[model samples]
Target: MRILVTGGAGFIGSHLTDAFLSRGDEVAVLDDLSTGRPGRLDPRVAVHQVSVTDAAALAAVVDAVRPELICHLAAQIDVRASVEDPAADARTNVIGTINVLEAARAGGARVLFASTGGALYGMDAAIPSAEDQFPEPEAPYGTAKYCAEQYIGLANRLHGTAHSVLRLGNVYGPRQDPAGEAGVVAIFCGKVSRGEQPVIYGDGGQTRDYVHVGDVADAFLAAADAPRPGVWNIGTGAETSILTLADVIGQVSGRPVEPGFGPARPGELRRSALDVTRAAGELGWKAATSLEEGVASVYAWVLAGEPDR
Candidate 1:
């Protein structure tokens, strides 16, 4: 299969691109380099330095690639930044998704959107939220992703396209940017490597379903092989508190590391996890990497000076 992965030079996208290439699929990438780095991708992969927000250029790439499947991973993923400037976030996460859907439609390609399970469900949501739960996003980033998902469903209904949405958990692993607002695992690992105390927000009791990027890449592959259009929660169905995560990092670092506490940021979920039973039944996908193992990988990557590829 011919696949085009937008933001394929980023952390999870880069890993997903590798998965496709490993299976003997021809893959291409579309990234703006604002956050994605070209060095993360394989040298043989053709990367189009185009942002999904640019409809014309994205459409041109889509036309040229004529991919059978498009994994849309490009977006403004920062929740705090979304709260600061919602319009900018919408331009990237919302409007950018529409542009990808349009390009896919023109080329008769199917789309696999990278939606957010961590941010979409609100603070009051169930411990393990399902696909049927009402989305009560606290920030523009989640709202934009949810809105983009609606467009995907609409496209499916109107055009009979089998585009799918994968509501993802908090993905983290090697190649993740430690400086980013997301990927607490990467951030904490970086802090541990530099001998800095990890900062805990709101007593560190807040929890999330931290899924590994490699497992997330596997989920994408499974969804790509499935012959249908539907939303699936890709997660471990387990909630790990921030405090517990810090403990895991300390254990992986092989040292005693204390943490500092700070006031909780606004528009953040208190506790969230996705019920991935549907994904298991439908896509044959489940997160296989344990938190300890995943954290160790990130720590090792950080120790290696955080190589791009």
Candidate 2:
């Protein structure tokens, strides 16, 4: 199969590109190099330095590649940044997704969108939120993702296409940028390596479903192989709190971490997890890496000078 991965030089996208290539599939990458580094990608893969927001360039690349499947992972992923400038976030997350879908239609390609499970649900949502729950996003980032999913659904209905959406949990693993607002695991690992105390915001009790990058790649593979279009939550179906995560990191690093407490950030979710039962049943996919094991990988990667590959 020929596959095209948007934002393929970034953390999760690079890992997913590896998964597809290992299986003997042809892969190409489309990235703008804003936050994505070319060094993260394989030398053999042809990378088009194009942003998804640029419709003409993106369409030209899509038409040239003519991929059978497109894994759309490009987006403005910062929550705080989205709060500051929603139009910019919408231009990338919302309008950018529309461009991908439109380009996919022209090339007769199927799309697999990387949606957000952590940000999609509201503060009052169930512990393990299901796919059927109403999305009450607190920030523009999440709202933009949900709005993009709507376009995907509309395309499927109007064109009778089988594009799928994967509502991803808080993904973290090697190659993740520690400076990013998200990817708490990577940030914590970096701080631990530097002997800097990890800061806890809002009592350190807020929780999230931190899925590993490798497992997330497997979920994409499973979704690609499936013969239908649908929404699936890719997560561990369990919640891990910030304080507990720090404990796990400490254990992994073989050091006792005394975290510094600070005032909680406003508009943050207190608890969040995804009910991945549907993905397990339909896509036959489940997160296999334990939090301790994943955190250890990130720590090792950070210690290794944070190599892109």
Candidate 3:
């Protein structure tokens, strides 16, 4: 199948692109290199240096590629940035999504949206949040993603556009931008590598469901193969505290460093985890990699200087 992956140069999208290409699918990657690095994108995959906000460019690419499937992953993913400037977040996550959907609809392509599991569901409602739970997004980023999800659903209903919304947990692995707000694993690992004590916010007890990027990529692959449209939570259904995550990172990197407590950021979820039972039943998807394994892979990659061709 021919597929187009927006933000395919970024961490999660790159992994997904690799997965699709490895499965013998022709792939085209559209990325503006805002947060996505150029080196991370595979040379074999067709590359288009364009932002999703540019509807004309996106539409042209979609028309040329005429992809049977479109994996929309490009967005302003920083939650803090969203809080600072919500309009920017909406322009990217919401408007950019509409552009993708419009281009896909014009080109007769199906879409697979990368929605946030934690952001959409906010704090833990039922220990591990399920898809059916009401989403009370505390931040602008979550609100934008949720809004986009609704647009995707509407597009499916009205335009006959098929889409799968993968409400993802905290996905961490190699190639993740350490500077970004979402990349706690990379940020912690980088700090620990430099022999600096990692800073923990709000008593270091805030918990998140850390799913591996590879596992998240596999879920997208499964979504590509699955029939019909649906929303599914992609996570391990387990919560790991930030304190424990720091310890695990130190252990994995073989670097001993203390954690310093800092005041927690506002609008941040205290605890977030997802129940992946629906994904398992519908898409036969599961979070296969452990946090230890995922962190170790990231640490090793960072130690090796993040090489790509």
lDDT of 3 by residue, 37-130 (tens): 7687678888899999999999999999899999999988888889999999999999999999999989899999999988888664777999
TM-score for each predicted model, relative to the true structure:
0.99, 0.99, 0.97
Where is model 3 more than 4 Å wrong at Cα? Answer: none
lDDT of 1 by residue, 170-286 (tens): 999999988777888999999999988888879999999999999999999999999899899998999999999999999999977689999999889999999999999998888
RMSD of each: 0.7, 0.8, 1.1
Name the runs in model 2 displaced over 4 angstroms: none
TM-score of 1: 0.99
lDDT against true structure, model 1: 0.94
Query: Candidate 3: what lDDT?
Result: 0.90
List per-prediction Cα lDDT, in the order shown: 0.94, 0.94, 0.90
Q: Write the per-residue lDDT of candidate 2 for residues 59-130, one digit (tens) a residue.
A: 999999999999999999988899899999999999999999999999999999999999999888988999
* Candidate 2, residue 108: how far the Cα is off, in Å: 0.5
Ranking by lDDT: 2, 1, 3
Stretch of 10 with least lDDT, candidate 3: 300-309
